[model samples]
Target chain A: MGLDQPLEGALAPPMRNGELAFEEPWQGRVFGMAKALCDAGCFEWAEFQAQLVETIREWERTPEGEYASAPAEQETYYNHFLAALERLLEAKQLVAGGAVEARSEAFAARPHGHDH
Target chain B: MSELKPQAIRAEALESLLIEQNHLTAEAVDEVIIRYNERVGPMNGARVVAKAWADPDYKACLLEDGTKAIEEFEFEGGEIDKLVVVENTATVHNVVVCTLCSCYPWGLLGLPPRWYKDPAYRSRIVREPRAVLAEFGVVLDDDVEVKVWDSSAEVRYMVLPMRPDAAAAMDERAVLELITRDAMIGVAR
Candidate 1:
């Protein structure tokens, strides 16, 4: 069927002055990484999407405060999105398993105000 | 400066690791982000909304076949393939959401805002739309019907808000200013 049919559901996105809003730089960066990787054919877009939805669903099923101090809802979702990407990369052998965790821990140890 | 949050660090780590492996370049990742920031965004959707507000034939075509009609503008991205344009009349209002994951009309609306992807919105909007709309400062009259469009990866939706009475004498260019990404998503009037 054509797209003329109205698919009704309640909807609204956080906005600032009628524009798409981003709270942090990494939110966009991680999103870009996923898009860029998929575009480069590292993995199919649908594969990432399926993983993302699964991650969110798993988060939803988890009990409250189970996610390591419970970040804001927005951050929480992106965290799951990030995890999905990591999982996809590891599964595809694009990046070694646990390498992201090791790398992140190393980056976290840098002196204050020093992020490369 | 405060320490970078773990998630941010993880994101950066992923970027750096991918770059190190040659699977991706920093420039390519930046290009995707830059494209969203500068080029592909709601303005594209606003142009479509304005065109529909101005040309009757185009409006009919848009309503009949949104995917084919919007191609006239040559927007980038495959998300528009199943584009569905829903109209808001005096008696009805429309909104868009993706409950499973955040599937938005990226070519038209840009990346969805944080709330759109939050569980609070994804779970609540379908059950209590009026309450949710009220929070967004959109209070419909008791008689006006509200229709929520649940977007899927295959078919995306955008709302065509009614031309405000004030813009009657104005041209399409002027009307374009009246359309916001929020309104096209059925959040604002």
Candidate 2:
């Protein structure tokens, strides 16, 4: 029932005082969602872990470094987490295809300042 | 094709979908955010620092075993591997960074500020601690030694910032209010 077992050793993210370190609020949100989903048995923990590993690997292979040099370029560890989560949810049929994209478009259409 | 968006947008989208599908509830998402924002954060670290400043015995325990000492406050997280507390003194100052990545003591300090995770900080802090501290407006004395702790997955560090003279008269809660996150990170004194 503990939240720490699946993310031990090589798979563990940088931590301080036993909590996961996140630079942005969304990073923690995404992280919490993934953990919550796993706890609810929507998918296996290993499944998400595999996807995350693939995402990180793909990022490492990109022409640029794993992170974008500029803020506008949009590369980050949590971005990959979102991408991987999307893939997992879609593949699991937990979410209908295009649901995430459609929701994202709706959010973008709003007038609020969107700084991620 | 869906455009790759920022993490916040994507997370929002994901949450909506999950809720719509009954995989998650809207309340769950709000609960997580509230937990991080309110229940856990720098205030926890500030309280710890305040207690250390007030009680020499607790400070001794904190310096000896940070992980165990922190548990006394009932702040426990599963992801933290090790907690090392570096004391800042008149002769030596300590700052922490994660060169390889943005490793931080989130259980005590909450989420890291944006600048702490910047590549410039990751690269520059190690090379020129004094100069970087200067940019943050922390000008150290010429005789003081600057020590930088690079946090890794195996171990994480928090700086025990030197107590200010004025703080001696303040109560624990007041002292806690004065301890900012930057000071605990050693970016500010």
Candidate 3:
């Protein structure tokens, strides 16, 4: 399948000269990571899209007013992206279940930039 | 070492697993990070804006064909399927958002600001752009028409911010410095 077909209606209609926008460094990181994973054959693009569709559906079920009341830090779409990715990786056994959660805790405890 | 957020940690772990499974290499992971940081950014867009400001022909070309004009800079990524450059004029202002999902021009403007992808922004910007702009401390005159562009995965939009008066005396490099990602996104002037 082509890249455009699966993405159709998955997002809003394209505006002229529009590009992918990232709000934070991690947003781009997550995007790049997902692309890298897809390139590596961990899962097909369609599989990830399925997970994403599921994630977005769950998010949409929340009452409209709930978003206004939610904390400022909780509004990242990439967070959902990560959640969906985690689900896929676990289902595929590409990474052991809970491995990411544990790694998250470890990094949070030490909190050091791992660049390079 | 700087502090690593939980998201960063998760990403690191994922990369490691990919490497361990022979799916990717450490070098490849590093290259991705570097690409996001250096290869793509607002600076690239700023240069295009600066060039447009300096040359009317270039501006016409940019407004006519954003994708081809941007390629003149020799940016490596081929992610943008189509690009549309909107001009912010005296009577018209343009702001962009993706209500369904966060689709933006990563190749030109780099990652969007946190607020750009916020649910509040996605839902509110289209309905009341002037009010949204005000909240961002950009209170335009009432006479100006605000055009809200909805971006998708196929086509991305960038605002060609009006060149500031100060830019008239400055070189292209100087003018480039004055262009912020938010300005290009039409959240700020």
DockQ of predicted candidate 1: 0.31
lDDT of 3 by residue, B1-189 (tens): 545456756766665565667766655544665665566778888888999988899999999999999887887544577899999999999998977666778778865665666777888898888898999999999899999999876688999999888999997667878998889999987
How do the residues A5-31 of candidate 3 rate in per-residue lDDT, one tens digit apiece?
Answer: 111112221222244344345554566
Q: Give the TM-score of candidate 1.
A: 0.87
CAPRI band for model 1: acceptable
The total number of steric clashes, by the backbone 3 Å criterion, in model 3 comes to 18
Over B1-189, each residue of candidate 2 has an lDDT whose tens digit, in order, gives 233345567677778667766788655654655556567788888998998998899999999989888887888433456788989999999999987656778788887766676667877899999999999999999999999999876688998999999999987778887898889999987
Of 2 and 3, the candidate ahead on TM-score is 3
A1-116 in candidate 2: lDDT tens per residue? 11111111122234454444554556666877886787678887567867876765676678765555634222376777788999999899888789888877776665533322
Q: What is the TM-score of chain B alone in each candidate?
A: 0.92, 0.88, 0.90
lDDT of 1 by residue, B1-189 (tens): 456678878887888888878888767877887777667778889999888888889999998988888987887754554989999999999988998889898898777776787666876789999999999999999899999889886789999989888887987778878998889988897
Name the 10 consecutive residues with the lowest summed lDDT in model 1 chain B: B72-81
Model 3 chain A scores worst on lDDT over the 10 consecutive residues at: A1-10
DockQ of each: 0.31, 0.23, 0.21
CAPRI category for model 3: incorrect
